[model samples]
Structure formats: C-alpha cells, structure tokens
Target: MEPELFIPARALSKFVYCPRLFHLEQAQGYWRDSEETRLGSHVHRVVDRPGSGLPPLQAIRAEGWRTRSVRLSSAELGVVAVCDVVEGVGDRTCPVEYRRGGPAPGGGPWPSERAQVLLQILLLVRHGYRCDHGCIWYDRVRRRVEVPWTWEAEREVLEALSEARAVAERAEPPPPLKHSNRCPGCALLGVCMPDEINELAGRDPEPPRRLLARDPDRFPCYVTEPGSTVGVRNGRIVVARGRERQLSMRLRDVLHLVLAGPVQLSSQAVHALAEQGSPVVWTSTGGWLKAVAVPVAGKHVELRRRQYTTSPAQGVDFARAIVLGKIRNCRTLLRRNGSLAASDRARLDDAIKRASRAEAVSTLLGVEGSAAAAYFQALPGAFRSDNRLPAPLFEQTGRTRRPPLDPVSCLLSYLYALLVKDLTVACYALGLDPYFGLYHRPRYGRPALVLDLAEEFRPLIADSTALTLINNRQADGGMFEVHPTAVALTRGGRRTVITAYERRLATEAVHPVFGYKLTYRRTLEVQARMFAAYLLDEIPRYTPCTTR
Candidate 1:
C-alpha cells in the first residue's frame, strides 16, 4: 500500500481535536467539504483577490507597494498547503491567516488556524525567509492575534504533525478520544462520532446485579444450598445439579424444572440466563432457576424484526427523492435571481447543458482527472469497471446527481457529506452503543455507525450538490479564472454554496409515494432510521435511489 501522506498544519488542528476525524479525512481520503471548509475557501479567495495589499519594501520607489506572495509546502514532511499572507517585518517574516470564526474555547486562537500558520512558517523557512511569528485575524471577533513561534510552539506544531501522520496511516478512522470537547468547532464533527465510541468503550462490562429466591421441587434430587454460583461454562450452569458431578442445564431451551433441594448459581449465570432472552431465578434451597437477561444476538430474528423495520425501496427511494428535490430547488433558485449577469449565466448554462448531455457524466466517471489520477497513478493495475462504476443502467442518460465542481453543485455535494457527517453525529447522539460496524467494520476505535449512515447519501447529497453548483450561476470557475479543483472550494464559493444549501433544505416537496410534503430534515431522519433498521435486520440491504 502507498504510504500515508502527512497532513498540513491546518489539518493537524483537526487531528489534535479528534484523531479519528483526522484519519477519516487525511488517511481515508473520504473528503466531504463542509460549510465551514467551503467558507474558509471563499475567504481565502477574497484574501488572494488581485491588488490585494502587501507590505512595502525599501528598495522599491516611495509609491511602490510592499506586498509579498505567500507560498507553502511540507513536501519533506509529506504535507502541503498555502498561506494567505506572508509579511516581511524588518529582517523577520510572519504569516497571517484570517479566521472565519472566533477564537477557540478558553480564549485560545483556533488550533487549526494556528497550525496553518506554523506550516506557513515552515514553508517560508524552507524557502529561506527569516520567519519568527504568525497571526490569526478573526473575522467574527474583528481581532488579530499574533502567534510567536517559540520553541514550545514549534515543538507542539511538529508533534501535532507527527500525530496526524500516525492517524492517517490507518485506512479506517481512529477510535474517538476518551474525553472529546477538545475542539468545539472541528470541521470533522460529522465524521468522528466520538460520543458513541466513548460510550461503547468506557461502559462497565460486568453483568448487571440480579436477585434470586428458593424453589423446592425438582431440584430435591440435588443437594441443598442458599448461595449462588459465580461462573458458567459450556452454555450450561456447571453447578452440582444433584449429589453427583455438575450437570449442565440448557438454560436457553428449557422452560422450567422444579426442584425441592437448594441449587446455587453465580451472578454470571443470572446474566447468561438473561442473555438467553428470558429471565431466570435461582432458588436458595431449590434448584437454581431464576429469570436472567438474554444476549440480544440470541433473541429470535422475529424479535429483532419487531424492533426496527424498513423496506429496500423505502431507503433508496427516500435518498433519491431528496436529491432530486434539492436539484430542482437549485434550478428554481438560480432562475428566480433574474439579476444574474450574462457571463455568469452563460457559465451556468454551459454547465447545465453539460449535465443535460448523457455523455458528460459517463465521460467524467471515465476520466481519471489530474486531481484523482495524482493519487491513484502509482497503483499497480489498469483501471477496470466494476459494479461500483458500472455503465449507466437507466434509460435516461445525464447527470445522475449533478455536474462536478459547479458552485451550487459543490455546495450540494458538500451538503451530502454534511448529511453523512450529520449521520455520524446522530450515531453519537443516539446511544445504540456499538461504535464500529460491518460495511465500515469495527476497527479498534472507528465509529462504524457514521460510516454506515454516510453510505447511501454519497450519491444523493455530495454528488448531487456538486452538480447543482455547476448548473447554477451561484458559483463558477470564471470568477477565479482558474478552474476550481473538484476537491477544493474557495471561501466565498463556500458561503454562497452553504447559504444556498440551507435555503434549499428549508424548501419542501411532497413525497411522490407518501403524498405528504416532507422537509429535507425529515427525509434525512427517515434515511437514518432505515439504516438502523438494516442493522437490526429489518431490511435485507440498502440501495441508493436511481432516477429515471
């Protein structure tokens, strides 16, 4: 396998707060740009806009502006990212990043932002710029906080980078932290379901306490005792059934066998009894038989069914319907704006036209663009199509979701990731207990629930949202002159996208089958429920909805 890439300073902040999250993003490469990430991109654009002021220099004429270009890279460490501003203060240089939000909790500058600055410092140092400090300019707080690169700060930055590298080494995300709440505004919140992991790992494993009573009937053949046995073996209570050697009782299959003498069972037996799906009672003097908790897995399949139920059609249909509705909403919103300039409209129309053409989507799927190819180019085997990337099955050919990299489409795609993230969040919110899963499989510390939840929405949310942005004038590469990377979004681009997403989500649509109008939020919850049902075996499998 290819070695894991080291994360840039900005990403290190994410890891420091939640190692699992850092793993999900950097290691797994399952990036789902969030509103915050997009917004940060948007802001970066504004900062990098032409004629952006830079510090003045002495060599240039008096009217000359002192502006220095910001360059960043961590190639040696295997991390890379760019800085917004690099200032030349006397003989020393400092990097400054504009924060989209307030300082971190306890009044510390945002760790990720600080990390970004440190990386910037490293970049400048590599390029022979005498760097000493970096500053984070908070937009919300309207304050600029300077970060001095002391030995401690540099060590911390390096340490954070090292830890991030370690986390990225795993294909799956790391286990959630023991005490999360370290980084309140972490972008990977949806990816890292820390609460669920914590709950599953920290819970006391010992069986619950039980009470027993004496029964005087069948057990008369055995000896008499009032105490309880502590351990069980071979699915049978290895207790002395009679005066002879210990006899095993099929605790699960047997209903009841009355005993006159006393039989004792340990607390473990009581738990085993309960796990058999029926409670057991052990008599102090009679044969030990009392109600006990049953292991959930042993419960009848029918019992599992009654608890959670959903249909294959329901889940896929729900996901597809949500995507379609959102796409339609995006089209409507763009048209209503009416004030869109010709160039912007032309760009959007071109994107939509491309999306409308059945060939484009197929072409996109086939092309291993530079961005995608860079990561996979070194792989051993030639590209081969499989079920995951099968040729179009539907009669209609076009964007299955939306065209890639359109501003609105970008927003929608990120929103899908957001939804997945939300599912990860919901997994934590709900105490279903198991932290890892089947499709996502339980690693020592992975949050399988979130991975499970995000599966169906990948096509529905992220792909569709990305298409919408392209099809609509809300965003386009024309603004930046350079075509936007499919994976990254500019800051202004992010805000425009997020605002539109929030608006689109609030819009309602009548469910084609249910006949009742449901908000996007409700649809997401239903999809989540269906996932829970699948886990409970109430559904056979999950399939994403395919549009005709």
Candidate 2:
C-alpha cells in the first residue's frame, strides 16, 4: 500500500481548533494572512531565528542541555512533523512550543496546543530520544506551562490526528462550525464563510457535490492587441507580438485564456491548453463574446440534475440579492463618480430602496432595469467634455445593447460582455452549470448563469472600468469606428480598454461583508463559489458581493 502523505505538526493545532479551516488552507490551497497570523509570525521570528541556535533557557541550561528545531517522522503513526524546540536536561528530553497567546487557567494548555506538543513528544520517542514531558511557552503572559505526558493526552492527540487525516482525504470541506467568535479573526473567513454554510445545515448533504474542490487554483491569462499570437513553445504557453516574444506562462497556472480581438491562437496551443482543461475565450474587436474553445471533458451528470431541480427553489432569493446588489452598486457609482441631475439622482435613490425591499424576482428585475436606465442616463455627465473625439460621436441615448450606436453604449456593451466572460469562467471553475443558474434561467447557448452572476459585478468591475476610460478621455475619436449598423473599437482602442480592464481586475478593494482585501477578479470567483456552496447545501444561503 502507498504511504499517506504527512500532515504538518501545526495542522494538529488547527485541526483541533477547526477542521474546516485546516482543510480550506491545506487541502484546498485557499490562504490569506490575518492580523493574528501576522502576530504569530512576528513572535516566531524571535524564537525560530536561524544560526542563533538555542537561546539560554534559564530552566534547562547548566544540565548538559541542547536545543534547536527538530524534525521527526514515524511510519508507525503515518505522520511526519517538525518539533519547535527540543531540550536536553541531563537525559530528560522535553519539547517546548512557542505560541502568541497565554496559557489557560489552572496550568493546562489549550487542547489544540496540547495536542501539538504531544505529537512532537510521540515523534521524539519514536526517533530514539527520551521524552516524557513537554512545555508550552505562551508569549502573551510570558509564562511557560509544563505539560506531563499522560495516557489520556496521548489518546486525544492520536485520535485527533486520525480525524484530521480522515478530513484531509475528503474532497469537499466538512461542515462549518456553528457561530463562533474566532470566525471573525480567521484569515480564511472570506473564503470559508462558515456562518453562511452552517445556516442551511438542516438540508441533506448532496454527496455528488463532494466532487467540487473547495477552492480550486485557477488563475486567469489575459491577451489583447492585434498581431499578438499565442503558441506552445517548449511545453509552455508563450505570447508574442509581431516577432518579439512578449511573455509566457505555464499552462497549469491558467484557468481561463481570454483572447481579445486580433489575437491569434495556434492549434497546438489550443490542444495543449485543452489537455490542461483550460478554455480559450474569443472576444470581438468591441469585446463581445464571439465564441469559446472548451475542452471535451465530461461533467458531473448529477450536478446538472441539482441545477435544474434544486436550483430553481433558490432563484427568487438569489435573484433578489443580485438585483438589490446591482442597484446598490449602481447608486454608489453614480453618487461617487457621476454628476446626476437632481431628478435622476432621486430616481436612483428610490430604485435602491425598492430593490432592497423587493421580495419577488419580478419586482427585483423591474427595480434593477429602472436603476440601469437612470444610471446610464446620468453616466454621460461623468465624462470630460475636452476629449479628442468629436462631441457628436460621444452623444448617446440611454444604454443600448445591440450595435451600440453611441460611444457610451458601445463602450458599455463591450465591457459588459467582457464581465460576462469572467463570471462564466468563475462558474465553470467552481464546478457550476454556467448555463443553468438560480437567477438567470437557462436559455439555449445563452449562459444565463453567467449573465446572472455578471449582474452583481457589472457596476463594481465593468462600469467602474468604463468610467475610468471615459472620464479620463484616454482614447481618441480614431480609436472607434462608427459603422452604419454598429460602432466598434479599433485596434488601439481595444488594446487601451483591455489594459484598463486588466488593471481594474487587479485593483484590490475591501470586501464589505467579510472585511478583507482582494482584487476584484478574486472577488468574482469568491462570490461564485459561495453560490455553488449554497446550491450544494454546503453553505446555508448565498450572499451577493455588495460593496459600500
């Protein structure tokens, strides 16, 4: 039989503290440093410094003592871990652990912390070293609490390790903890969302959903500008413009390959990407979705069943949340970036309230549509009049989707299309049926779920990027070609827009509900997975990504 991979010694502490958090970080690759984590690192620097060797332990010195970080492994326990500190006090070996907090009352360490040191002791005994006692050096109260190895403590640590191994081997995350104070300080809270998941614990566990990875590692690769070509070179996805090599990325790093207009893709490149299960999306010169080259991989058949049957029940609430979020964000953008007429501003404000109070999906949809009309009417006011473009070229009616005759309409249509592409990628990466959704009903080849998910992000990412482009007058009139039936961006125009769009995705903002900083692109993925978790009954309810 193959040997099971070793779990980190610190995982024992985290596993005992919270198994789901441990799984999210270790098993799922979702990590964000927190203040508590930062403080712990700072404290560890004092004790874990290299070449400094062991500091003079007033308690263990003068007795032929040696101390340093020790690594130990045991096949019997099927575990490998590093010991923080080992002390030699005249043939009596002891393991000491450093922590940022104080020891608990009555001279006993916290169960999780105790389990960690016990694991170290067990490993040391297996590694030909005498170990019967250990110590937890709590830095907060500046106290070192002595811990004697007992049968009960040994059993608890062993049982905890077994439980951790079981949890780690599972594909999906375990159930979340019921309301805890520690959730606030948890660095993974934004990704884990325990309260949201546990809220619906009364629902049955949909086992098929277990196939979904809690946090999949799928970053994006963006391409723009004409003459730029993508091809496979030496087992890497290389990008080049004209004859000069622009850059290259490992195929494994990319989840979605976005090829904006005029960007060519080699067949070999497509096959290589397909082998890695990455899709290449094609966009028009105006940034609208033209087509996509997705891999021919089989999906979870039952996932689609859940989407068709279980998803509709949640659609009303999800649609209301999305609509309310869209209106809220639209109002924010207008108040923050644009100068709206008094009446237009009042209409938007009223729309926000109505959308928030909307209980039915139809009511929410009406409120959202009204807000979009009011928002677009006020959008032109946000632009500078001193642009190189002819004043007539910039003039516009309220938002128009097809052909987009006016510059404002043209820019918005393109940007909204790009936003939809991103959300579609997010849904697919999260094992969701992008065509079927809670809010947007499945339409033949329409990707209604993508459209639905895009609603919440339209104002935050797309509209925000468009406003920056127009208000700054970054592109000239020559950048856009006005056709008899449609207006499209020229090569230079597409390049400029893609640059700005990429920048907007890279910009970090504090998540209003979770109180964490992540790029808008990351926020898009986070929100998508939150919805999937809810659909699979992993979380209690879905919360739309709404910014203040």
Quick one: best TM-score, which candidate? 2
lDDT of each: 0.45, 0.73
TM-score of 2: 0.63
Scored against the true structure, residue 248 in model 2 reaches a CA lDDT of: 85
What TM-score does each of the candidates earn?
0.37, 0.63
Query: Candidate 2: lDDT over CA atoms?
Result: 0.73
- Best of the candidates, lDDT: 2
Write one digit per residue (lDDT tens) for candidate 2, span 151-209: 88678788898899888877667887766666767777756766545534553332111
lDDT tens per residue, model 1, 1-548: 43356466667766765676666555544343446776876767666753434333334233323343344565677767556665564657667787778887777776666777877777666666666888888888888888777778778877877777876664334555544444345544433434423333444233211111111111111223323132467776555534544456555443322222244557676676544323232222211122222233221232224323434344333333332333333333334433234544454344334333423223322221221222112111111112122122211222223333333333444455445434543333232332444333357655554545554344344534443444453445532222433333444544454455544545455433233454554445444544443344334433332221
lDDT of 2 at 355: 69
The pairs that clash in candidate 2 are 196-540, 197-539, 197-540, 200-540
| Stretch of 10 with least lDDT, candidate 2 | 204-213
